[model samples]
Each structure stands twice: as structure tokens, then as C-alpha cells.
Target: MHVPDGFINAPVSIAAGAVAAGAIAVSLRGARRELAGGSPTAGFEDNRTAPLGGLVAAFIFAVQMLNFPVAAGTSGHLLGGALAAILVGPYTGVLCVSVVLLMQGVLFADGGLTALGVNITVMGVVTVAVAYGLFRGLLAVLPRSRRSVTVSAFLAALVSVPAAAAAFTLLYALGGTTDVPVGKVLTAMVGVHVLIGLGEAAITALTVGAVIAVRPDLVHGARGIITPLKLRVNGELVDAEAPAPDPVRSGSRRAVWATGLATTLVLAGVVSYYASANPDGLEKVAADQGIDAKADQYEHATADSPLADYGVKDVEDERLAGGLAGAIGVGATVAAGTGVLWVVRRRREDPAAPTHRSAGTAV
Candidate 1:
């Protein structure tokens, strides 16, 4: 959820800011390893990680715009932590959500600038941490199949949404600007978000399954865990082992990247127009519980931005304005996310280090 400016006090906001900063810093370092093809079967080099990470961020941004009705008078959008972590890596997933948050705050005026850190802490760090941890644990216990990966993605996303809600409740207890009872807030937040989590799980599992079907090697979580190819031997079926991963099979991720970007553009620019108009879970909870009493006192720092509120500032056509804003958001998120991931990749990819040949091709 996008916390507003006055929802939290100054001291706790600052502390949350520090926590966000620290998480980003650590993620940046960890991302270097992830982007460098560090996994046993991940043959990816800098190219795959950077472009895929950008696309993943933009996809998350696009999908987040499509808020589906979750309950009576309430809607929910994809939090995207499980999707990103499964597609890329956990560290890069955190950066993906962080990039989306930064874009929404500065350009879209969606999340309050003052609450940027809080949003990142709860949405980025908390969701990714919980989702990735649970996903890996489930994968360890479940059969190593594509279906298992999809199931893990679903379960991880299902848990992450409520976990994030709980984190927000705890933060509110420590630094809420209003006097709402913490127990009520927690119960309501958790209850509503549980329904929202079902939506999140469906989206996460479908997306992960689609990607795995097309390009399993590109999925960070699916790496080294795919069921081996089976061959019919003279008398029985047996595993067919590849002597070595074909470099060409690593192929160019350009096709997949381009396809993903196209899908992102369509979702943001066209599909977002039909998203549920009802207030999202957090907004509904805040309004019903009086938690946003002081939020009206403070204006968003980027309230005057051209793309504020996911609409063009001066565009008369509501559809045209929203469409344009969504397109712009996707482009900006892709650029910013790509830049950040490229930097992470560059820092760890030494000129002297041998190049890695990642497996799988989108075509």
C-alpha cells in the first residue's frame, strides 16, 4: 500500500527511511552476484539480467495499475514481490519494487514523497523477503517440476500480501498520526488483504507459469530445478542428460524482452482503463478506521507533476490521459530499472572474468 505523507510521524519515518536505504544498499551488492550468473545452472551474463530486470519492473508497474475488485467496495492490485523474485532474484526484486515506488512517488504522485521510505520498507523489503524465503522453502519440499514452481509462486504471493499488511499495522502502532486502535487496524488490514492475497497468488502463479513455459532458464527461482528431460530407453524411460548447455540455446533474450515490454505497454496503456474504480484495500481501511485523519493536512510533494494520479495534467479525455500516463510510467520505469540493474551488473562483471552462457531462448 502507498502510505500518505502524514500517516507516520517524523521520527519513525526517518527510521524507516534508514531501514529502506540499508535494504537497498544490501540488495545492490547482492544483486551483483545474482546478475553475474552465480547460480549453478544459470548461464546468464550481464545482458540477460539487466534487460529482464527492467522488463520485470515495468511489468510490475503495469500490473499494479490493474486493481481488481477484492471485496465489497474494495479493490486490490498486484504487489509483485513474488513475481519479481521468481523471475529475477530476491535482491533484484526488491530493487524492482523500489523503482516502481520511486516512479509512482516522483512522477505519478501516487505514493507520498514523505512516505516513500515507509512504502519501500513494507512493500519492497518485507514482501520480497517473505515471498522469496517461502518460495525457496516450498520448492525444497515439493517435487522439482514446473508445476511446483508455479505452486510455490502462488503460495508465496498469498502469504506476502498479508505479511505486508501486518508490517504496516506494526508500523502504525509505533508511529501512527491518528488514534485508531491498533488491534482494529491489524484485524481489518489482515482480513481485507487476505482476500487481496488470493488475487496476488493467481497473478503470480500465472505469470510465473507462462514465463517458465517459454523460458525456464531465465527464471531465477526455476534455475537448476527443472525436471530432467526423459528419454525412452530400450526397456524403460530414463533421464536424458545433456553433455553441456548449448550456448546458442542461451540465444538472445531480445525476443522475450521485447514481448514482455509489449505486454507491459498494453496492460498499462489499455487494460488499466478498465481496472476497478473502487478504493483499494488500504484506502478503504484507512477511511473506515479514521487512520487518515491527518493525511488531508499534508499535500503530496509531487502533486503538481504532469503525470500526477496516473493521468495527464491537462488532457481532457479521461481515457487518453490515463493511457498516456500509463505508457509514460512503463517507459520511465523500464529506463530507471534498467539503469540501476546495469550498474549492479557492471560492478560485479569484470572485464577479466569469463563470460557465462545462459540456457534457453524465448523463441
Candidate 2:
């Protein structure tokens, strides 16, 4: 959940900011390895992973705009941590969610500036860490099949939402500005979020399964997991020979990217128009438990932005205004995410870059 200003006290918020900063820094470094395919020969090269990472971030941003109703008076949306971690690597996934949070806070006045670190810690860090861990564990035991990967994605996503909610509850208990009972807050937050997680699971499973069906190579988590089946020849069962490496077809990659971007545009620009208007899970829980009694306004700097609150200011048509804002958000997030990931990928490919052990020795 996006924590608005004043939900957490200044001291705790500042501490969380430090934690978020550290985590982001570490992730940036770790992402280099992930984008490089675990080793020099394990994963997609920089050219492939960089743009794909950006697209993944933009997809998350767009899907988040489509808040599905979870309960009678509350709605929930994709946090994207599980989806990102399953599609991209875990470190890149963290950066993806962080980028979305930053864009939403500064450009859209969605998440509060003061609470940026809190949102990152709970939504970005915790969700990604837990989801990826569970996903890996499941993959370890489950049959190494495409279906297993999809199933793992579903279960990991299903748990991550409530885990994030639980994290928020703990943080509030530590630094909430109000006097609401911690027990009530935790119960309510976790309760509603459980329902939200079901929707998350469905979306994650379908999306992961679809990608695995089409281009499993592009999925970081699915790479090397699904092997070709065996065939019977001359009354003996033998492993099927691996197919010849297809020549790198830039056109195929471009087509996939174009299709994904078009889908993102459709969801954010049009489908979001019909999303549930009710307050989301956190907002409803806060209002019910009085945790939002001391909630403060967002930063004044973004108050007058033309795209504040996910709508274009001064536009007479609500649908047109929201559509424009969503499109703009998608564009900005993709650009920012792509730029960051490109730099990281470039560093990994640099001949002059120091190796991990070498840097450690120098230190």
C-alpha cells in the first residue's frame, strides 16, 4: 500500500528511508549479475534484458491503475513485486517497483513524499524479497515444468500481498501517529489483503503461463527450467536433441515489445476507466481502524501538477483527462526504468569494470 504523509512519524520514516536507499543500492549491483544471466553465459545479454526490464516496469505501472474490487467497499491492485520478480530477476524487480513508486509520488501525487521510504520498504522490498524466496523454494521442490513455474508464480503472488500488509501493520504499530489498537489494525489489514491476494494470484498465473507458452526464454525465472521431452526411436526412449540456436532476430523481440506496450496502453488508458472507484485495501482499513485520523497532505510541490491525482488538470472530460495522465505515467515510468536499467547493464558489460573480488580486495 502507498503510505500517505503522516502515517508514520518522522524519525521512523527517516530510518526507513535509509533502509530503502541501502536496499536500492545493493539491488542495483545485484541486478548487474542478474541481467548478465547469473554469469557471463547464463542469462540474456544486456541488449535483451535492458529493454525488457523497462517494459516490465511499465506493464506493472499500467496494471496497477486497474484496481479490481476485492470486497464490498474496498479495491486492490497489482503490487507487481511477484510479477516482476517472476518475469525479470529479483533485484531488477525491486528497481521496477521502486521506479513506479517514485513516479507515482512525484508526478501523480499518488503516494506521499514523506512516506516514500515506508512505501518502498513495505511494498517494494518486503514483497519482492518474500515472493522471490517462496518462488525459488517452490521451484526447487515442484516438478521442473512450465506449469510448475506458473503455479509457483501464483502461490508466491498470493502470499506477498498479505505479507506486505502485515509489514505495514508492524510499522504502524511502531510509529503510527494515531492511537488505534495494533491488533485491530493488523487483523483488518491482513484480512482484507488476503482477498486481494487471490486476484493477484490469478493475474500472476495467467500472465506467467502466457509468457512461458510463447517466449519462455524471455522469462528470467523460467530459463533452463523446462527441458524438451523425450521421444521414442527404434523401440528405445531417448532425450530429444536440443534445437539449433536460432539466429538473433531483432524483429521478433521488437514485435513482443510492441505488443506488450500496446497492451499496457490499453489497460492504463482505457480499461482503468472502469476500475473500481472504491478506496483500496489500505485506505479502507485505515479509515475503519482510525489509523488515518492523522494522515497529512501530500507534498505541496506536486499539488498543482497537470497530471496530479492521475488526471489532467483543467480537462473537462474525465475519461480523456485520466487517459492522458495514465499514458503519460506509462511513458515516464518506461523511460526512467529503461534509463536506470541501461546504465546498470552497461556497467556489467564494461571491460574496465572491477570484478567483485577485485573490488573487495581494493577495499
Candidate 3:
């Protein structure tokens, strides 16, 4: 949920900001290991996951443009924190969601600027925390199969939304700006989001399952769960996921990149136009809770941008303007995301070289 302005009180907002800052700090270190190099994630070091994380962020952005209605009027988009965390590692996932949030807040103005910290804390940190926690817990109890991983993805995503609502409630309780009863806000946010969570679970599971099915090697979270590489022993085929080769040669990576880029464009340019025209989870919560009483319209507000408000700035034809806006948005997000990801991947690759040192990393 993109928390708008004026919902949480100053103290609570500041507190949430501090919490988000700390989480981001922790995630930066985690991202370096996940991307750059080190133990616990040697296979998933910085270079590999960084560019991948940026792509995930951009994908989340494009997917969010295509909101689907859940309840009668309320709707939701991919929250992405859970999905990203499960697909990537949690530390990198946090960075992924943060990137998406930052883009939305600054460029798209989808989320409030003042409430930036809250949005990241609730949507990014909380969802990742909850989803990853649930996924790990389930993994421990369930079989260590690809199927189990998919199942975990489904359940983790389903639960993350409501858990996020609970976190929002606690934050509001700490720093609510209005007179609305905490119970009402909690009930409404959770109730509407439950339906949204179902959509999230489906999307998350399907995406994770598909990636695991194809390039399971690309999925940071599924590193150990790969089926042993099939091999010949006598006359029978040994069942095992293939071991990662020392120097990974490009295998269908071009195809994967092309597919991702194509998918992002289609979603942003075409499918987004048909997405449900309804207020999403946070918007609804704010209206219902009187938390949006002071949501000042965004500055740098795309009011003049040709694609301002997802419509061409001056194009007279609604269809044409919207189409162009969508196209532009797709291009921008893809380029931005690809650039960020490329940097991360390059950094990850450097650490693998014998002459590299992991010093001088700025948090």
C-alpha cells in the first residue's frame, strides 16, 4: 500500500522513518553480501543480485500499473516485497522494494513524499520481514522440493499483506493524526487488503514458480533447492539439480532478458490501460480513516508532464495520451531499473576476481 500524506502523526512518522532508515542500513550491508561477496550467500553475491534487484523493482513498478479489483471497489497491486524477497534474498529484496518505492514517490508520485519512510517501512520492510519469516518457517516444516518452495511463496505472500496492515495499525496508534478510532482503521485496512492479498499470493506464487521452473539458478532464494543435475550412472539417469558451473556461461540469459523487457513493456503499455480503475489498499484506508485530510497534491506533480497522471500532458485523444504515457513510463522504468541492476551485477562480479577487495563500500 502506498501510504499517502497526513496519516501518521509526527512522532510516529519520525519513528517509522528511523526504523526504515535502520532497516535500509542493514539491507545495504546485506545487499553487499548478496550482491558483492561474502559468506551465507557466496553464490548470490552483489553483482548478480543488484542488477536483478533493479529489474525486479522496475517489474514491480510496471505490474503495479495494472491494478486488479479485489472487493467491490477496492483494489491492490503487487506489494512486491514478499515476492521479491522470496525470488531474491531478503536483504536485496528490501533494497528492491525501496528502489520501487523511491521511484514511485519521486517520479510517479504514486506514494506521498512526506510519508516516504512510512511507506517503505510498512510496505517494504514489514512485508519482507513477514513474508520471509513465514517462508523460512514453512520451509523448515515442508519438504525441500521446488513444489514446497512454490507453496511457501504462495502462503508467505498471502499472509504478508494483512501483517502489513497490522503494522500500519501499530504505527497509526503510535502517531495517528486524526480522531478516527484505531479499531475502524485496522478493520477496514485488513478487510480490504485480505482480498488484495489473495491477488498478491496468486501473482507471487505464479511468478516465483515460473522462474523456479526455468532459471532456478537465477532465483537467489532457491539456490540450494534446485533439483540435482540429471546425470548418467550406469543406464539410469540420476535425479539432481545441475550444479552451478564455476564460471557461469550465459544460458538462455539473453532470452530471459528479452522476455523480461518484453513483459515489462506489454504490462506497462497495454495491460495497464485495462487495469481496474479503483483506489488501491492505502488510498482506501486513508479515506476511510480520515488519514488523508492533509495529503497536499504532489510538488513536481506531473501536472504538466506529457504523461502526467498517466495521461499524455497535452495530447487531446485520451487513448493516445494514455497509450503514450504508458509507453514512456515503461521505457523510463526499464531503463532506470536496468541501469541500477547492471551496476549491482557488475559490482557482484568484481568481488569474484582475485584482485578485488570489499573495502570502501558506502552504505
Candidate 4:
């Protein structure tokens, strides 16, 4: 749910901005460790984290356009926090979503420019923190298998949607511009988002399951859960050592990236044309509850942008205009995300060191 500018007053907006900035700074430092492999023996293959993170950001941008119908009138799309965290590390996951938000705000003009911090805090920080925290906890308690990891991802994503709704409710309560009753708003936001969460859960599970099926090693959440091969030595079973890092894996990684990018392109450029046209959860709730009474005063600063409202400004064909915008958005998100991750990766203390994790070791 992208909060518009007029929804919140200046003081609360500034406060939220400060919080978002601090979280981003902390995440950047944290990302260095994750991108560097989080261990001394991590192989160069761990370098895959950076580009994979970029792809995750672009994929989120693509999927967010596909607003699946929830209730009769409302719809919801993937927030992607749990999916990103499960595939990449949590810190990188935060950066991934943030990159998507930035691209949407600046280029597509989907989210308000002034409410950037609020969007990042609610959508980026809250979702990742809640989903990743719950995911790790569930993984700790559940059976140590790939299935458990997928289940945890599903549950975490399911809860994260309402968690984000609650966060927005709290923010509105603190500094809402309109005089709407907080109780009704809270109930409606959470209620609809719960149904949306089901969609979120399914998508997160399927994506995580698909990734795990092919390359469990690249999935950060599946790292410690997928058991390594064990050999019987004189009637006693022992954990087999991890195989040597292969040179051929680089080509394999290229293939993975190609497949992922192709999927993202198709989702945004072609499939998005069929997305639900009804209002999303937040927009519907705001309209139904009169939370956006003052939205007219604070119009989007980028309303005049060529790609405003997810369409090309002068394009007559709705489908073609939207398709071009979505395609452009995907490319912009990938480039921005990759550039940011590359900078973060460059800041590692020992860039040359291979920080490899043993097979089946917890991160």
C-alpha cells in the first residue's frame, strides 16, 4: 500500500523518513556481511548474492503490477519481502524492496514522492523485519528440511501483509490528515489484507519452492536446512564434505539469471495486461473509509512524468502504454538495484577472501 503525501502530516512524515534512513544505513552495513558470504570460508559463488538480489528487486517490481482479486472489489499484489528474504539474505532483501519502491516512485510515479520514507518503512522495513524474523523463528522450530523452509516462507509472507497494514494504521493514527475513525479503518485494513495475505503466501511459497527445487544452495533460507550427503564410515554415518567450488557453476548462474529475467519480463510486459483493474486494498479502504479526503490537495509531484500512473503519457493504446511502462520499470529497477548492491559488495573488508559456508550449516 503506497501512502500518498497528504495522508500524513509533516512531523510524522519527517519522523518516518528519519526512521527509514536509519534502517537503510543499518541494512547497508549488515548487507556487507551478507554479500561477503557471512563466513570466512564462503566461496566466490557467494558473489551470486548481489546479482540475484537485483533480479529479486526487478521481479518484485514486475509482480507488484499483477494485482490479483481478493474480495469482490478489492485486490492485492505481492509485497515480496518474504520472498526476497527467503531467496537472498534479509539485509539484501530490504535493499531489494527499497530499490523497487524507489523505481516506482521516481519513474513510474506509482507511489508518492513525498511519502517515500513511509512507503519504505511500512512496505520495506516492516514487511522484511516481520516476515524474516518469523521465518527464522519458524525454521528453528520446524523440521530441518526444504519443505519446512517453504512452509516458513509461506506463513511469514501471509502474516507480513497484515503486519504492514497494522503499521500503516498506526502511522495514520499518529498523523492522519483526515478525521476518519481509526477503529473502522483498522478493521477494514486488516480484514481485507488478511485475504490478500493468502495470495501473498501462495506466491511466496511457489516461488521459494521453485527456487529450492533447482538450486537450494543459492537460497539463503534453505542454506542450513537442506541436509548434505552422508557416507557410512565403518558402520557410522558421517557428514560428507562439501564439493570443491566448480568453475562451471558460473555458466550455470548465468543460465539462472537469464531464466529469472525472462520470467520477470514476461510477467510485467505481457501478463500484467490482464491484472485486475479494481482498486487495490489500500485504495479501496481509503475510498470506503474516507481516509483520502484530503488527497486532492497533495497531488503526486510526478503526475506530469511521462510514465505517470503506470502508463505512457501520450500513448493511446492502454495495453501498449502500460506494457511499455512496465518493461521500462523492470529494467530501471534491475539497474538501480544492481548498482546499489555492487557498491555495497565493494565495501567488504576482505573482498578477495572466499567466505564459504559448509553444506547444511546455519547462517
Candidate 5:
């Protein structure tokens, strides 16, 4: 959930900000290894990984805008932690969700500026960390198959939402702006979020299964799980020689990117129009538990921007204005996310970097 301003006191918010910043810093470093394909000269594959990562972020942003009805009065959406981690990697997944939160906060005014850290901590760092950990653990125990990977993704995502909700409950216990029973709030938050988790699980499973079907190599979590075909020799199974890395097909890459971008645009600009209007898990919980009684108004410079509240300011047609806003959001998120990830990938490839220098000096 996008935490608005004044939900958390200044002290806890500042602490969460520091935590979020630290997590991002660490993720940036980890993302380097992931984007580089686990080697220094991995820049050759950057063309494939970098753009795919950006597309994942954009897709997550668009899908998140489409909130599906959960219970009678509540709705839920994809948090994207497990989906991104399965498609990309854990570190990159955190970056992807952070990028979405930043874009939503600054550009769309969907999340509050002051609460950026809270949103990042709860929705980005916590979700990614928990989901990816569970995913890896399950992958270790499960059979080495695409189905297993999808199953892990589903379970990981299902648990991550409530984990994040629990984190938020702990944070609110420390810095909530209003006086409310922490126990009841915790119970309600976790309860409602569990329902939301079902939706998250389904979306994650479907998406991961689809990617694994098409390009299992592209899925970070599925790596090494899809083994080479074995041969029976003398009634004994032998590992087959691994295939060579396929040449980069620029046309295929372009096609996939174009198709993904088009799908994101369609979802945000058209499908989102029919999304459930009910309040999400967090909002419903807050209202029911009286945690939002002292909620402060969202006061940001861009609060009055044309695209604020996911609608154009002067556009009279609600549908058209919302569609334009969604389209713009998709474009902006892709551009911003792609640029950030490109820079990170390039930094990893920097030959003059300190790590390279030290290694050279040692040699």
C-alpha cells in the first residue's frame, strides 16, 4: 500500500528513510552482479538484461494500477516483489519496486512525498527481501522444473504481502500518528492482507510460468533449474553437454520489448478503467481500526499537477484523462527505470573502477 503523509511520525519516518536508503545502496551493488550475468565482462549481455529489467518495472507499475476486488469492501494489487525477483533478481527486484514507488510518489502523487521512505521500506525492501528469500529456499527443496519455480514464486509472493503488512504494523506501533490498539491493528492488517496475498500469488505464478515457458534463461530464479536433457548410456543417465549461448537476436529482443511495452500501455490506459474502486487492504484496515483518524492531507508541490490523482487536471472526460495519465505513467516509469538500471550496469562494466584497480595492482 502507498502510505500517505502523516501516517507515521517524523522520527520513525526518518529511521525508515535511512533503512530504505541503505537497502537501495546494497541493492545497487548486488544488481551489478546480476545484470552483468555474474562476471566482469558480462556487459555483453547487458543489452538483454537491462532492458528486460526496465520492462519488468513498467509492467509492475501498470499492473499495480489495476486493483482487483478481494473481499466485499477491499481490493488488492500486485506488489511485484516476487514477480520481479523471479524474472530478474532479488536486488534488481527491489530496485524495480522502488522505481515504481518513486514514480508514483513524485509524478502521479499516488503516494505521499514524506511517506516515500515508508512506502519503499514496506513495499520494496521488505517484500523483495522476504519473497526472494522464500523463493530461493523453496527452489532449493523443490524439484528442478519450471513448474516448481512457478510454485515457489506463487508461495513467495503469497507470504510477502503479509510480511510487509506485519512490518508496517511494527512500524506503526512505534510511530503511528494516532492512538489505536496495536494488537487489533496488527490482526486486521495481517488478516486483510492475507486475502490480498491470494491475488498476488496467482499473478506471480501466471507471469513467472509464462516467462519460463518462452525464455527460461531470461528468468533469474529459473537459472540452473532447467537442466539440459540427459542421455541414457548403458542404462545409466549422463548429463548432456550444455548448449552454447545463443547469439543475441536483436529482432527478437525488440519484438519482446515492443510487445511488453504495448501490453503495459493497454493495461494501464484501458484495463485500469475497470479496476475495482474499493479501498485497498491497508486503507480498509486503517479505516476499520481507526488508524487513519489523524491522517494528514497530502501536501506536496506536485499535488496540484495535472496528472495528480491519476487524472488530467483540465481534461473533462474522466476516462480520457485517466487513460492519458496511465499512459504517461507507463512511459515515465520505463524511461526512468531503464536509465537508472543502465547506469548501474555501466558502472559494473567500468574498467577503471576500484575493484579492477585493486585486482590489477595485486597481479
Candidate 6:
């Protein structure tokens, strides 16, 4: 949910900004180890995943444009930090949501650049940390099946949305520009967002289940717990001595790249046009609580850009204008995300690292 320009005061925004900066800094270093370690295919020297990470960010960006209606007026988009982390990796997932937030802030003026830190902290950090924590906890106690992984994903996403809503209420109470009681804000926000959480859980589960079924190795949440497929020569069947990971016979990193990019393009270029035309979670709460009074206008880098505000300037057709703008967003976000991940991945790749152990390319 975009907080817009006004909801939070300057002091709280600044504090959030500092916290976001520190989190992003920490995420970058963590991503280096995550991208480098625990994967057979994604080697310490592999720069291939840079493009993949970028595609994930763009995918999340496009998906966020398709808001599903939760009630009469309030809708919700995919708060993808947990889903992305489960699909990719935690550090990369954090980076992915951060990229989406950054693009929305600077390009579309959806979120405030001044409050970029706040958005990332709330949406990216909080969701990822909460989702990953719960996911790991469940995996520790449950059977290490792909189905278990998918179940955990659903539960993680379900919890993260409400947790974010609670966090927003707390932040607003600290820096609200309103005379409304904190208890009222908390009750309304949590009540409405519980419905929103169902949507989040569905998307997270479906996406994670699909990827885990195909490319379990590529799944960040499924990492370090994979049991490779083994062929029993005498028995004439493929099996595992231990608990087996879901087969990835047709799933590869290349396949994930192709599928993810295609999904992003389709959603942004075609499907986003049909998304419900209702305000999202934050917008509804703001209007209900009179939090829009101090809302300032956004100063976006793309304010003068032809494809600003998800509409192509001079395109009379609403469908056409939105379609073109959505496509542009997908393309730009993918490129920007790739560039950032490239730099991050390049710096940590040890070019001369061993090749014998990491020889296979299934991942």
C-alpha cells in the first residue's frame, strides 16, 4: 500500500528514512553471501543471476499494478517481499521490493521519494523478515516436502500483510497529522487488512507452489533443503534415498527467466488494464481517517515523462494509454533492476573459484 505524500509527519519519515538506509545497506551485503553461497548452479563467480534478479523485481512491479478488490472501495496489490524471497532469496527479495518501491516513488509518483525509506522499511524489510522467519521456523518443524514449502509460503504471506498494517498504524500514531484516536486507526486498518491478507496469501502460495514444483533449487525458501532426484538402476525408477525435492526436469534457471519475464510482460501490458479501479488499503484508510489533509504533491523524476502516472500522454484511449505506460514501466524496471543486481553480483563473484563441485547446471 502506497502511503502517498502526507500520511506521516516529517520527523517520523526521517526516522524511517534512516532505518531504511541501514536496512538496504545490510541487505546488499547479505545478498552477496546469499547469491554466492548454497547454490550449485549460481556459483560465486556467476553473473547470470543479475538479470534474473532484475526480472524478479520487474515482475513484482508489474504485479503490484493489478490491484484486486477486497471490499467495496479498498483493494490490494501483491506485497511481494515474502513471495519474492521464497522464489528467489531473502536478500535478493528485499532488493526486489526495494527496486519496485524506488521505481514507483521516482517514476509514477505512487510513493514519495522523500518517504522512500519508509515504504521500503515497511513493505520490504518488515514483510521479508516476518515471512522468512516464519518460513524457516515451519521448515524446522514440518516435513521437508515441496507441499510443506508452499504451505509455509501461504501462512507467511497471510501474516505479513496484517503485520505491515499494524506497523503502519504504529508509525501513524507516532507521526500522524490527525486528531483521530490511535485505537480507531488501529482497529479500522487491521479489520480491513485482514481481508487484504487473504489475497496476499493466495498470490504468494500460487506463485511459490508453481516455482517450487518446477525449480525448487531456484526457490530461495527451498534452498539448503533440497534433496536431489536419484535413479535407481535396479528398481528402474527415479527416487531419493532421503526426502526428495520436487523434480525440475523441465525447470532450469533459463526456464525461470523466460517464464518470469513473460509473466511480467503479459501482466503489465495486458492484464493491468482490467485491475479494479478502487483505492488500495492505504488510500481507503487515509480517506476514512482524514489523513489526506496534509498530503503534498509528489515531485517525481518522470513528472514530465510522456508515460507518467501509468498513462501515455496524448493517448485518447484509456486502455491504450494505460497499456503503453504499463509496458514502459515493466521495461524500465527490468533494466534498472538488472543494472543494480549486476553491480552487486559482479563485485562478489570470485572469478577463479572452483568449478568441479559446481559443474552441473540443473539449478
Q: What is the TM-score of each candidate against the true structure?
A: 0.92, 0.93, 0.85, 0.94, 0.94, 0.87
Candidate 5 has an lDDT of 0.88
lDDT per residue, candidate 2, 172-279, as tens digits?
988999999899998999999999999989988998898888788889899879877799999998999987866665677788888988999999899999999999
- What residue runs in model 1 are displaced by over 4 Å at the alpha carbon? 39-46, 230-239, 243-252, 349-363
Residue 260, model 4: lDDT of 96
Q: Please report how far candidate 1 places residue 230 from its true position, in Å.
A: 4.7
Q: For candidate 4, which ten residues in a row score worst on lDDT?
A: 38-47
Write model 1 residue lDDT over 1-363, tens digit each, in one string: 788899999888999999999999999988887887775224444378888999999999999999999889999999998889989999999999999999999999998888899999999999999999999999999998999999999999999999999999999999999999999999999999999999999999999999999889899999989878899999899999777855665454677888889999999999999999999999999999999999999998889899989999889999999999999999999999999999877666447766666677343
After the best TM-score superposition of candidate 4, give how far the Cα of residue 318 lies from its true spot, in angstroms: 1.6
Encode model 6's per-residue lDDT on 1-363: one tens digit a residue.
Answer: 877666788899999989888888987877876666544336766444577678888988898999999998889898888887777678888888999998887777677776787798889989999988898898898887888898899999999888888888888989986777889888888888789889989998998888777667667678766656778788686765665444453355667788788888889989999998899888898888877767744445456767667888899999989888888898889998888877777677466877555556664
Selected candidate, larger TM-score, 1 vs 5: 5
**Candidate 3: how many backbone clashes?**
18
Whole-model lDDT per candidate: 0.92, 0.89, 0.77, 0.90, 0.88, 0.81
| Model 1 worst lDDT window (10 residues) | 38-47
Candidate 3 residue-wise lDDT, 45-158, digit = tens: 334455556667777878888899887778888898898898678987887788777777665656666778998999999999999999989988887789999899999999
Deviation from native of the Cα of residue 349 in model 2, angstroms: 4.3
Model 3 regions more than 4 Å off: 36-47, 229-251, 296-306, 341-363
lDDT of 3: 0.77
In model 3, how large is the Cα lDDT of residue 9? 67
Question: Between candidates 1 and 4, which one is better according to lDDT?
Answer: 1
| lDDT winner | 1
Candidate 4 Cα errors over 4 Å, as ranges: 40-45, 350-363
Model 5 vs truth, CA RMSD: 3.2
59: Cα error in model 5, Å: 0.7
Better candidate by TM-score, 4 or 6? 4
Residue-wise C-alpha lDDT for candidate 4, range 27-83, written one tens digit per residue: 898887778777533543467888999999999999999999998889999999889
Better of 1 and 2 by TM-score: 2
